[model samples]
Target: MPKQLFHHFNKYLELTEEHFQEILPFFEIRILKKKEVLMEAGNMCTHNHFVLEGCLHMFFLNDKGTERTVQFAIENWWITDDLAYLNQTTTDFSIQAVENTRLLTITHDKQGQLLKEFPQLEKYFRTIYQISYGAALVKMRYLFGLTKEEIYFHFTEQFPLFAQRVPQYLIASFLGLTPEYVSEIRAKKRS
Candidate 1:
């Protein structure tokens, strides 16, 4: 693992060398095959994952059994069932590997211990949650108000790599559109 990944943590809080060493020991590296489920609805989320490579998606199945993607996390991103993780209850969402993925996982118990042992880690996580919350709020607003074409363009502009890696159907679900609508939008954009 490139120590550079730690820079994401450093952005929010200053970690002393000793603190970093203490925190590092608590994280375990995990690899997942594509389509593997990390956390499923009705199961407690045991760990929070920081992606080192590939993509993961958080989604819930509708009453009709269709998957509605709520969020996608690519390399250098974090993914977890935030509500379940914090409440220590069953998750409503499912988190799955969209591609073969490398992740650094920190268990809830270990994370709590890390907070007590290294206050800097607490500060880092607080900042991360704040950003995640804000982004989710914006995405919800856009999904309610924007057209499929607008959503596609916005996502492509902000996360071109994700647009390239994720399948169009998944992107359509994220945008609250059908696959045909997504295909139509892409065709229009190309012309």
Candidate 2:
């Protein structure tokens, strides 16, 4: 678990043994069953979860009572409602386990303590957030200008393993398209 954590941080910044040791105690490992909701709308998000294995989705229910998937985090990714977790407010999104998943969760309070205890580690987290923010912006641009087929192709190219691992319907939701349309696109691609 520490190895996974170490690698995840390394993607952003190098952490020394002392810095890692300071942040290590704040994390707790959690196992989640498929379809389990880790966070719900209207509740404060207490933990930022790092995926060790399997998948999780962050989504919201639309007025039409449909699930609109905002993000999917597979192995080595992180999931959290940033607004709620950082500000201590209720979340508008729900995070659920899409498959049997192992995760490391760090609480908001502990994260603050970590920053104070190991200032160098703060650079790692800042880099992570900057990357996440940039990705979100790219996604928004795609959503605004791209067709469903283009978006699906982009998703496939970006996350080929997830394309195979996740269910088609969930992928459709993530792409903001109907399952039938997504199926048609997939069929066309295969031929």
Candidates' TM-scores? 0.93, 0.93
RMSD of 1: 1.5
Alpha-carbon error at 72 in model 2, in Å? 0.8
Worst 10-residue lDDT window, candidate 2:
14-23
- For model 2, residues 139-172, the per-residue Cα lDDT tens digits are 8898889987999999889889889888888888
Error in Å for residue 166 of model 2: 1.2
Q: What is the alpha-carbon lDDT for the whole of candidate 1?
A: 0.85
TM-score of 2: 0.93
Please report, in order, the local distance difference test score of every candidate based on alpha carbons.
Answer: 0.85, 0.88
Could you give me the TM-score of model 1 versus the true structure?
0.93
Give per-residue CA lDDT, model 1, range 1-191, as digits (tens).
73545777777777666656666888999999999988889898878999988899999999999999999998778899887898788898998899998999988899888788777677778888899999989998887887767888898889888888999889888878889988887788789
